[model samples]
Target chain A: MCSMKVVVCVKQIPDPAGNLRLDQASHNLVREGKLILDESDSYGVEMGLQLAEQAGGGEVTLVSMAPNSETSGLRTALAMGAANAILVSDPALGGTDALGTAKILAAAIKRAEPDLILAATESSDGYTGTVPVQVAELLGLPSVTFSKKVTVAGDKVIVERQTELGYDEVEVGLPALVTVTAGVVEPRYPSFKGIMAAKSKPVEELSVADLGLDTSEVGTAGSRQQVVSVVPAEARSAGEIVTDDGEGFQHILAYLERIKVI
Target chain B: MTLNVIWVVVDRTGDKVATVSLELLSKARQLATTVEAVTWGDPSQIAEVVGAHGAQTMHSVGDLGGGLPGPAVGAAIADQVRSGSSPDAIFIPQTYNGRDIAGRLSARLDRPVLTNIVDVEESGSGLITEHAIFGGTEVLRASFTAAGPGLFVIRAKSFAAEPGTDGAATTDNWNVPDLASTGAAKIISSHVEESEGPKLDEAPVVVSGGRGLGDAASYQLIENVAKLLKGAAGASRAIVDAGWVPYSHQVGQTGKTVKPTVYIACGISGATQHMVGMKNSKNIIAINKDQEAPIFSIADLGIVGDVKKVLPQLIEALEKRN
Candidate 1:
């Protein structure tokens, strides 16, 4: 019923549609060239903005931990009407696992002091799906994840938490954390005017030290898990290829019979 | 020399256990001296089922009266570990609520969770987890360096479910600790999406569509073919993210993993994300306009043609035969 301050965690990942490479030496993803907002996080940004708007008047802040102070992705969310952004970038943060990232985010989000924090259920790049909950725990807040639908009512936030078979309508108090599944909402494209306005938006930059996190607690050293090895998935060799060739359907039928699918 | 592992079973309806629970139990038995289970349901009802799948002790936390039981369950497990019954590791199936409990428990125990694990094997002094990252392009191996009670959230269908000779398990009532915030998030209502025919993961035959279906309306062709074959309809992450299909129908890394007898992909240039989910199917048939589509690589049979043209023919031929 009142103004609600929201924070959304966004990620700048290599475009999922493009080719991705791995740093063979470090056994990490090679982050290079242009980085864009992860498609999955767009829903979180949209949800945060909408929740803020519904509360009559509020601000949606973006928080991210990325390499090279990636603002391109945050700008896209800012263009969609977020008030501002906070990016914590450092080379020391490289090779950090999900838990380390959560520690950094938890500290940054605490500074924002939002009524709610929203994040994607998982990142398209890491696909860890653990940081949001970890952040909630670190802040001593309740969290509901895999929310397909979310609504703010009075002091409680209600969500339709997605499950394997269906969904459960869960209600949590304000200042809680929620990780949304994709398709929760249709993310709006930045209008020309909105894009122009985003250029003037404030983006606060911070380092791991600024968050009061020791360098040892926020990077590969702080990571609880170690990547023992990185190997390309066994390539599935090409199988029998058939052109339309008039008899293609019959060939498929015979193949189906061989597999006993019929 | 022996490891004690606890497997958390998600039993929402109080009747049936999730398939992934049994799958984890099967794998847990191999890596642990004792495979204990925790569930939020009547222990008597699920004891035999879990025991048949290798669980030795069942810690049951009966229904939480329409509340999300994550915090309560996590607290109960933490209490067990704190009271000198700490297990070597805790394995949880990667589900909505499972992550919630794992996160809460990890924070309570001050340990980190290794999530999205697709495979696990016994390693030197511990277990190693295999993660498929970057849309399943790379496989990374990791293990915990911490002490006991390493938490893991495992993916579905990662291991085969097998029944053990034991037909019953010793059950104990787990007392849920009263917490100020455990009751904060309450489940007012729940609904299962109305699906016709068989479920996607259990369906013997699955017909899936992707972005190449062009628009949402064209998705009907995928359904029609699936209907003709008495199979379930599925979709790739591309189509699901595009809002063409519900998340329940999505078959990929972030979605449900289906190992159907036959998986037919239409208009899908399978990304590694989509392939990992259904690549384990007994037979894969991919139909896409592009010959070099990644889907064709894993497909037992590949049709390099327009799906709009080919799907109609396949349906018509199946109808005639029927």
Candidate 2:
């Protein structure tokens, strides 16, 4: 059986470091600044590499859609052993949410006819794990989501789905999608040899037009959804710490009982 | 009359309804006597159940899974907007499925959707709903000025539903056709993972482990306690990143945000990601060998003791109570 072609859908977003920020007028994460590949997306990249390696001979392509600096994240993927990388960056592709991002990525996957699509279960800042499922929906591909472990048998992709309570064993036909969890595989550090080789690998930068995606169908315009506003959640008041000192503890217990904590 | 909107019950799966469906049914009856309910999946005889909940007549969409996301339950309500008799607000449990339904419905119906509301009260123009945000750090109230229906999603356990609320009408048949072609998406199949413990989102007691648990085997201490109490178990992203817990068990900014009544942290050093998840728990207990651990910042009870030693005692106490 031929090895499967895997595409890891990655997103470059604002670094979560100063995540709690208020823009002057918009009260949003100001976009005129630092952005990086979402950290969880690295797990998706790592899973793609592992799957490709286990299959003997195949390619793992890291694909992203955003402004041009998004390619930096692709380099991180390249460092991790992705066979090739692609960045769909253009002013037109800016501010795309999960649905819009998926539309662009689905188009990119169709170009290579990948057997499997991998993505992180969630983004660090946006915190919405909605993209992978939405993309699978658009591509009409079956999805085994929140997957902690993944395997392949012929053309079937088997995975263990991570859920709120436990895990499930599921197998879907190839040309499927999986949103990877941290349990899937530990991402490899950029080895010196891999870093040298990554330079030789292909990283073709493309614009929204190259994917045959109506750029209007991308970004805020393409998004059927929008975060109407972003505000730092209200601050928490300092709580009164209580000690279990007999009578003093009784007061604490009364307070706890009032809040029904005990 | 608080508009007493009675919602029809539909099973989440393609088959029979669940107990939570009845819970929603009872709550919907309490919401209003007008009883405009939307029932998806096996809508037959739902009106009978709806009628018993004080519904004037239940609104039902039949044989729903013709090919739709499970959240079509919300879209059906949106698409079947009625003649001056639609609900002023729509309420749903803030489940993963429920949130999606509320989001999609809010988008399609052009209403404001507020999630994780614990209660609703009468306000100046409409209703004010309360939500727990920034973990459990703050409680906030919001009211919509929009004229149409306001959408709300609450946890299933947030309100207790009493049965046989005398005036409930029988489950009525509502056939909503518009949901069939509203979106270009459909769920061919959905296989859920089998998890131990109570449904994490709805659980009252939750115990979490973190990187300090040291190894995967060490998680058994947390799991043992969870099993004894049949409560949910959680993990910090550090532990999830360290490979001790699956991402699904992760409680943090990038993972599931839960508000259990009692949440216990064992060996977890509270990171921002971790705090965002369990911050809303009514009570928090932290057991870390490190007295300097950040988990103590949010813990109502802090024990500067080894979790490996402390967990066994906690499990025994809970088991002894049983």
Candidate 3:
């Protein structure tokens, strides 16, 4: 019914479709490749845009913690109609874990003074699935994760929180955080005109220092865990692959018998 | 390194403790000299089960008063650590509440959390955790470089849960601190989807369908095969996102992690996200129209066929055999 300032936590990750290379030294995904808006974050962007639109006023701002000052991903979201973006990029943020990332995002999000904060339940690449809640805890705000559906009513937000059994109707006062599940909404593709206009969208770049975070509080130095070893998981040996020869079910039946499940 | 004390976060609904909690307790017992358990509800309800799993002590924050348990419960545990009973590591099952509590605790303590753990061990007084990445293709072993009480959020079925002769755990009450605004979120109501047969994660056999099942009505084929097999029905995120099924049936990253004895994936083009959840199944069978679907890479038997045709034939054959 009024202005709804929603801040969406977006992640600029290496494209999943492309070859992924792990950094030999850091044991993290190599950032040398081009970065794109993580597909999971698009759902949150779309959800934020819709919520702001339904309220008839206000704007959606994007907050991201990325390497190499990646604005390419932010531009895509901005083109899709986010008003502006805040990017926290610093060499010191190379190996930030979920909690460390949360601290940085929470700092930037506070600057936006949003009524609601939205993020994907987890990033497509990292899949840590804990940042939004950690950010909420850091900001002293209540959080609801895995929201399949969200509604804003006055100063409170009602969410259909996805759970193991089904879903729970969760209600939290505004100025809270909610992590949207993937496919909660279809993200709109940037129109040609929108894309052209996005070139001028404001993307404010900041560093760890800008956020007043000490170097030892944000990155590899601040990371509590270190990769001890990396090894290939034991691969499942390939088995027989057959085209249906009108008796495919027989093979399944025989296999079941061999396994003695039938 | 042998840990002096390890704590397992027990998740329960009424009297039934989550299998993952017992699994963690078992693993914790092996790694530490002492294993403890914590929960949000009455510690007595799960005390015997947790004790049998090797938890020597149980802690509870009592009822959450309709509030989400994360903030209050997390703070309670943090208070215990601040007051002196600091465990070497805290093992949390990778469930909805587990992640929330772990995240809250990590934030409150200014520590980092290692999640998606598939295996954990103690080496030189610290804990090492293994995580499957890129759809279980690679495993990364990590260890906390910081201080005590390393928080680990582990996946289900990562370890065998065996019961000891221990009868009951010594119980203690943990204080729920003033949560301020963090405890304002409340579960106003809840719904549990009506499911028959075994739960998807607990079933010995699981039959899953994806978008290739055509329409919402075709999902019945998945349920039919699962029923005839005395298994559980699951779905890929694509169909669940398409609103064809409830989220309870989704088997994938961001969904349920299931390690059934046999997993039959029908009409599902295996994405890494989907595979992450079910790849650990003892045996995998994928039937997809596309031979190139990644599901075949791990499937013990790959059948390239239309699920519409193959499912009916399989269902009929199963019925006749029964």
Candidate 4:
């Protein structure tokens, strides 16, 4: 039986279904509301768990960086069968950008010492889509992003990375980072028994200092960029509305002709 | 201009420069006195187009063979920066390889990258990037508080591609620096999926479907309508997530942003994420049974009807007209 230890990076985000509020002072999405497992990260967690199960006697560890030492999202991943979790939370990490976040995750991930790392291509909230690769570079490891399908042999990870035209088959050795695209695997819901067990699973919490990172290199002070201002975008005005009445085609045709697209 | 020089990382297929790259070059010209290009492939073939788009020089990282270009290209640029030759800011299109290269460069240089940017402007104080949030309802403007060489990853079609009076760009080749372990990932093989008609993002007209179309089988109606109009077929994130269509066909924040002359969203309820990508289309036409669908908010013309019935009539009518 193949034994592969995988570390999955998860993010706790404001529920997409609920109203989203930005922190006025920082211009960051306010996470004061009870944060939940970002829907995007669930796919990575599920993929990691599946890969571990396929490898027989292996474990999938969770790594997250959030404020208020958020463990609610970690519990969900644990309930989905992650063995343990590492949480890196500190007030100093408030204004961290993609690069700072990557530094924190890379440091926390090193403690897991896994054979592979999995993360969503982009988080639902920030959506910079650069953190995973940044983590890979900070750790000095190879990475493949936008992976739709992933498999592991004895010492190599094979990924089918999504591209504009199609997909590319990529191969890298063990201890590599991979960013999974959404819908790669259907994430399973947490079962009652699994949920109960997750409450007792070990959750190791670390601070910015705990991860051997200096405050000068993280948070608002450490950030190389900042939000200057935010303004409402110019709204697109709505035009004509009509019931189909078996005549909707005529309107579309008229618009097409007016635009000279025909 | 606020910035002295700016570099646009060109993404290309063979000799043809990607439209987004030209768009960035055009914007870069407006932001800086000098605009240059950095690309992975040989620059000799694409110098003309990039130059016409306002790039004065094309910096090539040489051919990467089958290996991924992220590590090599990023490393090469970092080396240049360290050697005292770097642009004030770099503009990279938010493509698969583009993000990878930007990420590597950010990590290597310990800089931050602003991504998902839909607009960029000079704020006098510095460069500001505008991001469309909440489905383009709000714009968040951000800038680099630190000094030198800011990295920006912009979405496709964020800026128009306009050719300047420049001729062919002078080409400069940079050797791919040794990447060691960082260059381990290699492309073993690539499969290009079969696509029909005009490319989705470049099509003058786009026809997209959502979950309201019922099942995977019903998606063909979107394709048929697109073909009838000589356009391209697209899908909302809902349908793509439901496995009704491939992710390539998805149009949303996490998908390809298309600013076609006309966008036809059929049976889509207009999720915020979906609208962020296509809401900027010159003309939007939404067809959904639910009249209150958020898609109607930005639609130039809204049809409250069942796509199952409406799409067929539309298809038949278009065919008769042709």
Candidate 5:
């Protein structure tokens, strides 16, 4: 693998489907004081770090799209093992849906000019599994996602892609974009040595305008998919457990028969 | 007036293919007055398959659908829409690769994507697509903007494969689509992994065990029942945390929300998280020693005896049936 530059896109979302407490009035997920790496994004982060480590010379820069106040996770990435970090934050970037998110990422990728860009296939919140593909479209670059294993040698990039029943092996040229699945690699726990090393890495902060993005082209205003409303699902009632082995066995069989599982 | 439905044919694994594309021919024979079925790759052979499916003609995007390569296929589809060959409704399989292509095409054309759909209904001039969210607990109703192009992803085994048995297959050579030049980012190597068994989301039966299974050996009853039923196996968060089962099979908010047709709970206390995963199942059967265990309320069938005892009898009955 060559020492090609790599950029990792990280998002700090509320834990996957955590009791997303909403403000009573605004109906926004109350996440001012809490955030973690979007569970799905871990795959992308781990993949990017693996690439850089394999190359042995180029660095992996952790870049995040979030409000300026929510930049700690990006720093945490630095603390983990990122060679450097950057925060692309601004009020204008708020409430960007997946497409808006992709547009923002495209601008960020262009600004970084990295040879490779990696991201999670989806954000657990949206579960659309569309951002990386959308980002590829917005950037007009060749991007294939759900890649399980990635190897780079010379000008070619080889990836093990997750398919419906099995996997397929495909090789493409360099400087492309890919989104990874969980099997990419296990993320390393940050040690004291890595945490201290991260402290010395440079972090560049950029606002929305600094990237030369058309603010109108990215954000809630640019998105077509709107969240009409999110209601808490009804609570399931306590279940019944029958103890009579004879009757219970019959009941279980009857239940399965009713559902046509038999 | 009826709307155009362009059914995108896919292979068994959900990957796009020419043979499966022809299956659309059988349905097209019914709806082709306004509906069109398109086979996206192999200009000559796929078009014949599409014709058999009832397409008056095929729309070919150069180097897509089969052996065309993933990224190129994606851009070619986008180029077709950009060139005004937009579909009123598009159908693709809900496989991993299919969704990636669907996601890309949706983004490139700036279309709203409703993914992993199970069924579609028409409402006046607009169409409604039904989607299952959070595994299956929530069913979302969506209608495309008036006469908007709708994308439908069909689950394998949900729709029966129809061959071109009823219609004569027609053939055409569609001119390849021209891809718009984009910034060139070189390709990388790719690999594929093969996964089998009933997928967690679509399995018909799921047998889940909890901490009451005692230890490793106690967990065997759950597996035996699952095997007898030809079903997927799952575990509660408690059992998973105890190292009784791999976390992949954990049924909870943090794990998988499965909508199997039948869910059998063994020794589970019915924690809220576990309930969230199996509550949407069509029929729930709970087996726990405690007669008042929380899992019984929602269960269609309740067995208050030990799962170890109950499961063997059930399996024996199944064996007798076979």
Candidate 6:
């Protein structure tokens, strides 16, 4: 068995391209219906699988916290070749902010005892972009964010972290946390055999108590920030629509000139 | 009661400050009674610019070598808070390093971080922040319930950078604490992605392509039009994920957020993910065959036609004028 153990954090979010509904009473996303693995987390899962493969022989474990004991998203990651999954589901997790979510994930990660941790830079739904770093901090491990490329050597992990202009080559020792950006790798589709195997793949379920987290500290009661109000963005007034009758390009040119962009 | 706010500055190559840092400094000045600028590297390099941007004091953490010094920088700032010089709030850019620092600081202080904020305003001696959610379809206003030291990681171009007439800022050295585990992560080497044209985020004009272009070869139409207009070429997340273009060209919620003067969308259906990046552009022009495409919802000028035909005609029109 390979000594390298990796834990990848995956999230289940409402399909961005689908029609979404919100809970009227609490003003929260209605996440109980038809949730799938977030597209953003696919890159991290792919990176984890690739790194595990590169390490000669290792297992890729997935960790997630969703409402209603959702195993569909975790199973999807397992179908992509993860060895096992751990899900933290409880009503107390409802309305938990990014920091609270991080605390729970950090505790679960400690139980997995992986040498490396991988996560997406941001979630499709929440998009907080702070949880991975928060997990790293809570676990007291070195962390790197926005990695476009990652490779593992004997006891050291090297990554090309994306910067505003380009990328910086960063090297970190084992037991480090890294967040991957989208398009970092081409995610693979699960095969028939892999899908079949995923059904039997070990999925360990835990709750706030199992993770040694207090309900008061893991839910809305523990949230530091509160949404005061939410409003729809100002609808963009429809503009001129020109049919392409040979003068279409001319109209565009004139518009650009009017805006002084040409 | 005067509020003390700290704004983190990111230094670009050749010692210039990032535009987002200056923007934060400008906004922070208006929100707080005193705005202090924190940065790594030599203080003299950015002291004048930061001061002009409304910073009264400049805190320098010296240098922590080549690789990113996120842990060390965060530790230094946390030390300042622990020493009883705690500021009421701290603002950090949404860059990679900025997020790292914010995360580390939040962990150290056991505080919550309000991230991806686009606006902030003072309310009753505290601050309220606004964030775009659901791919910019809705806006949410949030505030801290507990006392702060509220930490925020703000997006670029959310607020325009305006320099004030303030004089040079007073400089002070901050003692960077020893990093126990964070020191292990070091930079081996660095490489900048090679591109000949203007950057997507900085370009005044941007021409972006989407999956509707059909194939990779058709993407050249976008590049050609961008070159003719002296703009930069961009891509939708769909095309970028499909490997039709580099990730640097992606413009969306997950990609670079651009607010160019003029943005041209070619055959893009304008998914919420893609619209979030360029919705703030001064003028948006979309060319797609689909009349019901969402791109037209926010576009200033919409052309209902095939991109394959319209792009060439538009290119010819520009060429003839030149």
Task: Tell me each candidate's RMSD, in Å, in order.
Answer: 1.8, 6.1, 1.4, 1.5, 5.7, 1.7
TM-score per candidate, chains pooled: 0.96, 0.72, 0.97, 0.97, 0.75, 0.96
- Where does candidate 4 chain B have its weakest 10-residue lDDT segment? B11-20
| Tens-place lDDT digits, model 4, residues A193-256 | 9999999999999999999999889888888888877888898988899999888878888888
Per-residue lDDT tens digits for candidate 2, residues A55-174, read: 777989887776754566667678888988777778886556555666677777778789888988666655545556556655656565666778887877667654333555666667
| Every candidate's lDDT | 0.85, 0.63, 0.90, 0.90, 0.63, 0.86
How far is A173's C-alpha from truth in model 6 (Å)?
1.1
Supply the DockQ value of model 3: 0.77
Each candidate: chain B TM-score: 0.94, 0.75, 0.97, 0.97, 0.61, 0.94
lDDT, candidate 3, B26-107, per-residue tens: 9888888899899977788788989999999899999898898789879998998989989888999999889999999999
Model 1 misplaced stretches (Cα beyond 4 Å)? B1-14, B134-137
Among all candidates shown, the one with the greatest DockQ: 4
Score residue B160 of candidate 2 by CA lDDT. Answer: 52
- In angstroms, give how far residue B86 of model 3 lies from its true place: 0.6
Worst 10 residues of 1 chain B by lDDT: B5-14
Tell me the lDDT of candidate 6: 0.86
Instruction: Kindly report which residue pairs in candidate 3 clash with one another.
Output: B1-B123, B1-B124, B1-B125
Worst 10 residues of 6 chain B by lDDT: B6-15
Angstrom error of the Cα, residue B218, model 2: value is: 3.3
Native interface contacts kept by each candidate, as a fraction: 0.69, 0.06, 0.82, 0.88, 0.45, 0.77
Show pairs that collide, candidate 1.
Answer: none
Off by over 4 Å in 5: A21-30, A193-202, A227-239, A242-262, B1-33, B41-70, B116-125, B128-223, B232-261, B265-281, B286-322
Using lDDT as the measure, name the better of candidate 1 and candidate 6: 6
Computed on C-alphas against the true complex, the DockQ of each candidate is 0.66, 0.13, 0.77, 0.80, 0.34, 0.73
For A29-57, candidate 1 gives per-residue lDDT tens digits of 88898899998999999999899888887
Q: For candidate 1, lDDT tens digit of each residue in B1-322?
A: 3465656555444368888888998988888878889988677877888899998889887777776767778888888889988888899888777878887787777777898899988787788899877556678898887677789899888999999789888998888887676447778887877799998998999999998889999999999989988899999987887888889999988888899999999988988788778887888898888987888878889988878888878888988888
